[model samples]
Target: MRRVLAELALGVRLAFAGGRRGWLRTAMATLGVGIGAAGLLLAASVPTMLDGRQARTDARYDSPGGVTVPAGRTTILAGPDGQSGDNAIRARLLWPEAPGAPLPPGVPAFPGDHQMYVSPALRAALDGPDGDTLRRQMPYEIVGTIAPAGLSGPHEYAYYAGYQRATALVEQQVAWRVDRFGYPSLDVEAGAGGTYVIVAVLVATLLLPVAIFIGAALRFGGDSRDRRLAAIRLIGADSRAVLRMAIGESLVPAGLGLLLGLLFYLLIRGQVERFWLFDVSVYSADVRPVPSLAVLAVAVILGLSAGVTLLGFRGVTVEPLGVLRQAPTWRGRLWWRLIAPAASLLLLYPVLLGRENVGEARTGIGAVLLIVALIPLLPYVVPVVARLLPDGTASWQLASQQLRRNPSSSTRAVSGIVVAVAGAIALQSLFGAAEVERSIPYDKADPAFLLQARDRTSTDAMKQRSARFEQVSGVRAGTVALYTIYQKDIIGLANLYIGDCRSLSQLATLTGGCEPGDTFTAGSAEKVITIDKGEINPAPGVRLAVPAKARKATLIGSNAQGVASAVLMTTIPAQLARVEPGFVETRMFTDEKPAVVAGKLRGVAAEIDPLAMFTAMAPEGDRFGPLRVALNVGSTLILLMMAVGLLLDVAARLHERRRILGVLAAVGARDGTVIWSVLLQVIVPVAAGLSLAVGAGTGIGALLMRLSQVPVIFTAGTVLLPVAAGAGLVLITTVAVLLPAVRRVTRTEELRYE
Candidate 1:
């Protein structure tokens, strides 16, 4: 035990003993592992962050999804919260029943008379240069800011305004009496299936590659390291001692890198308020890493680093004279590499084909397996591609030969890039396929406008509502549909249908169109209700000059107004125009973008009808707006990460070969040949690897789409986009690493060890 400890301590001393090269390897390992650590930590924090945000929100409301309380001294009248659609302001009116009524969290006291309390984000917006429009809408006296405890995030927009007439608002049904705020805490998933899958797969995509690179970094300066180990072997230490020393060397950097990553994650949390994505913001305190996941991440990174370093010494013999490395052979390792992908497909086939309920987490597991499975295929793939390259020149022969070797070091270094790109393509395909399923073919256009109201029997108010509806943008015209009752039946216009020639024509067909104030009896109204064809008294003190003979017009097949039966009176007689309506509707015929128009009209209608039953006759499927945004951002970030990892891996490999290239140059080899050889070494293998990546990604996406019960939406663009991106990555990595590789190869000192 003591001897083993002595050797381990000796390895640590030797890690930093070899000047700049040793320290550079350590630094690179730290950075590589650090990146992976940070990614894992951030992914782990997502669930916790969302829960904390929900908790804060629930705590602030006193009762989440509110309940009405009995009017009492300690009760407050509150309600009618604003929606997120317009300016995202959560505007609410609060009227305290007594001075001792409990207040919301984060609020020290109620605002002064005629004053409103706003969130910090809201205050900032209102005070900014472009707050004029909002100010006009909310022209209340601003007394102070609502503290953080009352908000979901720093960017949330909310305001609590004092209402003087709480009783009147309660009576109007706009506000309700509540003894307290908020409800019990609800534990929410960061996102349900789509969201969770997106986040998880994205995190895995980025992290797996980083893990590969960390292993590569840990084994860097290999030639220098072997020579040092050879010296130890000469001094009577056995292979076990050498291996322990190697583990020690790798452990220090692995440990440091993981620790650095944890520190970086904490720093990110400290400034969490400054960050926002997918239209979401979180508080600093809410961003916390799950301890179990964090620990696992550290363990994984450290284990991988040490393991890869240990593997580097495989099949090498250290003698007293020099270190003898057995030739790197990967000739017959194909079968094992195929097992992972085969298993991955098996796991997913049940879900996609049989429609089995294996659960979302299991599918996520399948996706992750499929994404990294390509790494195992790299060795088999590279040789096949290299054989296709023309070996007409010295550089071509050299590159082709290097690829044919498929040394373990080369394989590990390139694995990160391959996995990253494969994962990206898979993610894109999944989204596109899901999109095809979500956005079904356009349904037959159902009416977008249908407003309902109750016992609103005032002619002037109904007319005014119609006029306001016309004011809504895109509304071509507006008309009032008065649904009168007969025999207490609540079906469509049972008693009367009165409108002018132009307005009533939209509801039903009229032969040659009649004059203004026309009247018609159709549906049940025709059979039961009787109308005199003269000046008749429909109600006391309300007399209408009825038509001598009413025309029976045909109701239109379908319309924006979702009514089964209509009076089809294209024109109401001019004399009966003043008849009051029993129940009213300001129906709208809006242009394209009916949703926007409908939303604006809803706000407008709220002035007259506190509870507006705004319903779209036909439902519109979700467009995956947030999913698209997340994919765009995630793709961009992962691509950048892929590029960096590829660059570093290629860099380390180049540095490892500096001695050989320097010796070749010393023997009169041309610099151009060396540079081209290195470039070809990467390009040819990557070209083949990327093709496999695309195939694998598409397959994974197809399975996910099937599991989601959506049609596969494969397009030329989906396949071609990842190809273009891979091509670009190769181009960028080539430009980034070439000059330095050439400089190192031509350096006189690079051949010192040789």
Candidate 2:
């Protein structure tokens, strides 16, 4: 034990002494590890940050004790014409049953009768700089605002009315049992299977780059350290001692890097908090690493550094005379290189082809394995690409020769780039796939605006208000539809037109023309009027029955302008329809912008819920935006680490080739020849790795898109960005790092020393 402690002390002393002599190299090495560690920390902290945000959301939305509505006693507001809006506001009465009773964390207690507190978003809509027109329509006392935590989505708008007023409105309308008393939450109803697959892909994207960076950092200063340890072995150290010494040496820089990483994380925590997920930035406090995770990250970084250092020692066998080197000198077999990636493809085929309904766990494992497979494949591709390069310029030939001669070293130098480029391509392709805009099923060529009422406002009242609103400038035309919930249907129904059949045909898209007094049913073919359920009475004691199966009917039509499972077009007065009291859906075609038109109409009703037609047509920005940002940032970091690793490896190789460079100079070789030779050494491997990466990345991206059922779009911009950026970085690094080192080594003075 004492002897082991002495060896550890000696190893640490040597590391410090080495750093003292060449602090720049030590600092660079530390910086590389530090960047890698920082990435690991950030990646690991994502779950914690999301968890904290969820906790905050739950705390804000969950109610402790409130007037819980009985299961079947809830009232849903529909349009006055017995039609239901697609997104109808639920009516809730918040009166202070106990004035002094405590409320949930974010819920505000009811103020007084006739006055109500609204959600922050609703308040902004009603009282913002442009909300004066809307404020006048409701005319309730502006008391307080509900926090975003109390609602489903941060942008969701909600209304609260005096208990008596809300109750009276419910009594007059179609009232179901109250669902709950707490604020509503924005529920994400996407398939859990798809979400899991996306999440798994995201995790792989983050972790793979981090692993490559750390691996590169561990191998930094490889050649010099190997020679130094070789000398120690010649002096009498055994293999165990040599391994311990290497671990100790690596531990110094790795320990410092861990500290630097922690500081880096702290510095970037604020910026991380600003990163959007689901179009919302989480609270700053939520973007923190958990204590246990922070500790674990440190331990993992340390263990990885030590483990890699010891593993490298396996190539060196210690003897009393010296160390015998068994480093890979010749390419053994090319077929082995295809094994991992080929297996990965086999595993992915089922998922990508949709042959298997594998859950998230299998999908995640497959994704991780696919990325891991790419790492080993890169090194083998180096030699294969070298063989393909035709003999050309002296620089090119020299570079290709070196790649063929010692493929492993060259492969190691650019391995990070391979991983980074491939990952970037895959992510960009995924983003492109995700960003493809979905065509709106509703009318896109026409100008339209939707207006919905709040509280217990009737369709007639909404119509009167809409009539006044149509008088505003920029209004081209307008129509009002009453929304209601029917007892027989699961969804709400709407009255498309209340006038003659001619007006109904003019108002809606119909397959068949109708005459005056002719009754028509409008809905999707799937929900067609059945013989038993088609007896819709347009007026008191007046019933109309259709003799067609609901599924096979041809008179049905679909409209996206408002929420309605089916539309009833009749000459009966809308007020006489057996619709439970509901809100009115007023749609207008206007020359004015939707926002402006909505603002103008807000003053026309107590609540105006504008349909998000444009928003609905847009791609899922909330899901794809944050993912793009994360992948880009992570890829950039990985590329930076690769550049550093390449530079380090080139510097080390140049040091090894100094004598040869000096000999060439002595034999009349020009500075340009030496510089070109050195540049090729780095360039050839980079070209080979990048080529493989691009091909593999594109294939992987296409496969993933197929799995997600998104069309693969290989745009020129997306394809060229990663390649150009990688090539540019390589060219710049070669000129900046290798050129200078080559010029220095080829000097006459350097030759004289040799």
Tell me the TM-score of each prediction against the true structure: 0.76, 0.75
Write candidate 1's Cα lDDT for 412-460 as tens digits. Answer: 5556666767766767777676555432222333245666654434445
> Could you tell me how far off, in angstroms, the CA of residue 307 lies in candidate 2 after the best superposition?
2.6
- Each model's lDDT: 0.65, 0.57
Q: Cα deviation of 261 in candidate 2 (Å)?
A: 2.5
What is the overall TM-score of model 1 with all chains considered together? 0.76
- In the range 11-41, model 2's lDDT, one tens digit per residue, is 7776655554345455665776686678678
Worst ten-residue run, lDDT, model 1?
Answer: 533-542
Tell me the deviation in Å of residue 355 in model 2. 4.2
